[model samples]
Target: MTTRPRTPSRTPSRRALLRAMAALPVAALVLGEAPGLLGTALAAAPPSGSATRYTIVPFLNSDDGTVNVYQSDDATDFRLVQSSAYTPPSNRIRDASVFKHTDGYYYLTYTTHTWQDVSTTIGFARSSDRVGWTFLYDYTVPIANLSRAWAPEWFVDSDGSVNVIVSCSTTNDEWIFTPYVLKAANSALTAWSSPVALSGIGANHIDTFIVRIGSTYHAFTKNETAKYIEYATASSLTGPYTITRTGDWAGWGSYREGPALVQLDNGGWRIFFDGYGDGNYYYSDSYDTFATWSAPTALPGISGTARHFTVVKETVTGGVSITKNATRSLRSVNYTTRYWEEQSALLNLPVVTSSSATADKQAATFTVVAGLADANGYSFRDAAGNYLRHYNYRGRFDANDGTSTFAKDATFVARTGTASGAVRFESYNYPGYYLRHYNYQLRLERSDGTDLFRQDSSFVPATAWA
Candidate 1:
């Protein structure tokens, strides 16, 4: 059995490292757009919701022949989330990638192999929630002469088609590794199309990540021989991509691999790759069209040894107020349901139903305004911009146009709903009382306190003001 080196000696000087990188025939292809065109193309757009970045790192346990799953909220800090032993036809799992689909499913793909044994099979699994995963099938590349498969990364197109790019060796005798593309037959990924080589003959490529920025598709891959992250761009997903850029930013001598790219919230891009020589992850950022990058910086807070991994953003939407409270009630345009008053001797409160509005309590029209407290929180405003406030002490809610001050009472936290594009609101001050639908009417009441509130409390996106 051939044992892979756990760590390589990091004794090379900075001067020697730079000299090694400079010796390579690095090419730079600059496809510059007009300043106005670039601005319009790369303009930052608000995400559907508050996005959370999630990363999956694999910890290969040779002793137990198991791979432990470590996850991170921020890319730096990681914690063990799951661990499973290797089963038959597979010895261990490594170089895992996690991809979240629009259908609310996360698919995990990893390289399956015995100890030092090369194989063409890649393990696959799917999870509704990120926690519990169900093993699907061993996705064997249809290449008849393939020797080994490594690092598999999945990309879902805008049209919902699923494609996976994997690095594999052609034969068992040679270490030449190249990337191959495979398209999933269906969203479930039960079957796949025949594998096609991404790179030309004699060109070594590994750890590939495909990212679409504006109208162009960019593929970032590690040149195994040169040990640097190189990039290629094409107008289409599956294409004859042009080699645009190539260089080792870390200048760590040819020990870096597994390049991953993520678009930051600031409309910039960050590239993360493993510094295998130093046994650490390093990152660099680009703000100006990926032309140049900041110096590679070492990431902190990572505990265990993580090999190839991938990061994805979790889409979360915020909440918005539909209507206000006053002499006028809030009515749904699609339904006869109107926010009406439940007149009682003890307490008169607002409820949404098919009941007709009275003269004393007419339907109230509200402007769904942005939140004053936070971007995720929303304020229910009257036409005049008066917010609806919830009294935390007494649980009394009212739409008061009198006060100019925007407090917690006027703000509600928006959480994504179970249904697609739906959102639920929770009182910012009184977290217990969620703005939910009760008795088929809109009411501020304590949630069943389940994992999520009912569908009635959920509201889909209506028209937004210009």
Candidate 2:
């Protein structure tokens, strides 16, 4: 195994780290004014606000048969990085996906099979810097004990709620458990909402991925006999999804599983699903939906059966990164953490904004608008540089009035911090958290504990208002 040199570690104040995590940029796609079942929360927007520049994050098996990360910036040229070990449950990770949430964490969900029975569970890990990562939560209970929830895909809504779409064939009359989306809160396996069905569409569904475009929630699932891709759209994530037998495949058993929705650079959509077989990879492209693809092309020699794949363009120190990783590890852990703040300069900082009547509110009414871009303890920062806050998803912050919910949006107090230019928010979670701008400067502990990467341009916030 090829190991990269350990990075230096210099512990920064808790406040500094919190600010870093909370500072990741948010660019809301202003869709048409419509709120129905298709009314998607802000979480479903395409990655990096671009609909072009289609890329793929491929999962590779090591020479020693461990799991590592290999990325293709252009879907054609692939390279590998010595990442964490892939301790499998059995032969290998059959199918998987690298799910990026609006809350700034990426989830790796996959299916693993052993000798006796087929089993699968969603492994939840986090990357504070979106590069180096700390494995956080792996489900104790298999998501569904049926024939196995294969290739689970994750989705986050505007309400800070998360859902997963998994494929399975159950014993309860329904032969195929039918690929459906299940809601999971934070990483709690028990906290998952009940399954929502997707059957009325097809029988052989596997590796389902859903993306919100405009007002429709589009689902991309793989069919066996047809060896073709199918799509469905609904207003809600947990939906009565309307089926569209829209597209077909190229190679035999070519388009197998793991259908990921990626936005292109020229402002369009590209479906990056896996092509199952030896020596060759399967992929299909379309600048316009409801139209025929240019045919399922081959991205050959990328990996040995690269099934589950995800793609995202993240702002990294070296340059922008398109990271891809997966899971089927034998051992894992799940933990719960919480963070609270004393409302410091970071939380109550002011931005330069002129006042308008629409911005004004009634007196003494604290309108706790929960969805601030950098509002969580994950984004906590203290001017004193002493305190640190770990903003895990379970953490929550509340204003007065008996209402509290954990999420990434900011809270607007109608009376106190609600006044324009009155609140400046900052917080940090573990890791080099996201910042809107590339110029964020701060003190951060490196891997070696003694050395640190401080005040780097990569940490800077690009948008001042953010």
Candidate 3:
């Protein structure tokens, strides 16, 4: 029983859907295929630039219970690639795990229900050719001494060691599956190590996915209560890891699971996840501290069952990558205590001028002009001074703006009331967030003590930075 979101009555094809979303101000290549149609499709091919194609599995046939694959040169268009239904000697197939190994082969693992039809086990298979696969192991590992297993994510360590993280629980208690990690090698399931518990993480974490960003390993897990994703960092592939960033969890949202993360060839991370009710997957770039994300919109297609999505660098002919200029401005501010980050450099208030009014009625307005930056949202705060009302960001504070910022570089208008005092813009950048404004300070400071380019207030009506 896979849970899929409901689709809109008048859903468009992938090409039409991408074309509709292309109207937003999100950062990406904007191209025109026809009137009211826009996408990332490029006629000319290059070794590296944009995602020339998209591949999906388990296409038309939902039965045979096989994992289908599809390919699209454009984000809006897709075609079938391959499908594999590895039953692994088990009676049923449920959750599946797929990854591209360093050895240049694709590896897949799925949860298999035991003969009793109550217990679940883990199975492994590999494919050099995407179509046909060879079964590697079968029903050798019972899911962490439990009868249930789901959502397996494969991680390859620096030394060619493969690690598996999964959601598991007692077969009878289907709603209580906990997340766990296991160690293994390319050899077989008999050589796999026992499950290791992760510190500072909880059983509530579900639909988990792990990725290697630079030298650090990060984990993104869905917090059902918060209704969003949370992030954790670990020094080693498997161990006592700590949750560093918890995204918008308690807000009015749903699903937000099935994280498909792919590092673009042009040095950006594209994360695809399902929106709870929209029956469509959403892609977000320029993530802030894993706690904050730009507003998520439906992906190009309406077919919503993406238990997990995978990305592979095409080495064959017709593969091309494009250099995407990230126009997202993430303004961040660091206070003595707590931290703040902006969804985009552009926010409701981009400029703030000192006023005689007190914190209760200090009338300050800033404009975030669209088309200047690929800003999806904005946040502001008085980091240096304490006022009666300070901005709170997801239980953390010292930031404000609106719940969301403008998607494009459009000018947004905002006024600060008496409760809120001096305002600053949130800076969004890779890995870290920096404060763009302090009370009466116009310069922005990087989290690592480096200084970003700053503009003098004398030339501008209000102190601001972009």
The TM-scores of all predictions, comma-separated, are: 0.56, 0.50, 0.52
Best by TM-score: 1
lDDT of 1 by residue, 1-466 (tens): 1111111133332223434543655310011122211011221222334533344645342322344565432233345676552232445666677766546677778777642455788988767756666777886787767877878887655455678888777653335577788887875678899887764322577788887766777788877667777778777776677877766543434667777766533345766777766656666666676777666666543422555667654433342233322223333322334342323211123434334344323223345555555444566654444456544222233545443333555666565454665556655543334565445445565444244344545555433211
Name the regions of candidate 3 deviating beyond 4 angstroms.
1-64, 73-77, 83-90, 113-117, 142-145, 171-174, 186-190, 247-252, 287-292, 320-466
Best by lDDT: 1
Ten contiguous residues with the weakest lDDT in model 2: 327-336
If ranked by TM-score, best first, what sequence of candidates would result? 1, 3, 2
lDDT of each: 0.54, 0.38, 0.42
After superposition, candidate 2 runs with Cα above 4 Å error: 1-65, 83-92, 101-104, 114-116, 129-145, 158-160, 172-177, 187-190, 246-255, 277-279, 300-305, 315-466
Tens-digit lDDT track of model 3 for 333-445? 32211112222221122332233223312223223222122222232232232111112211112222332232111211111111222222222221112223444333323
Better of 1 and 3 by TM-score: 1
Summarize candidate 2's per-residue lDDT along 382-426 as a digit string, tens digits.
223222221221112232232222222222111001122112122
User: Distance from true position, residue 312, model 2, in Å?
Assistant: 2.7
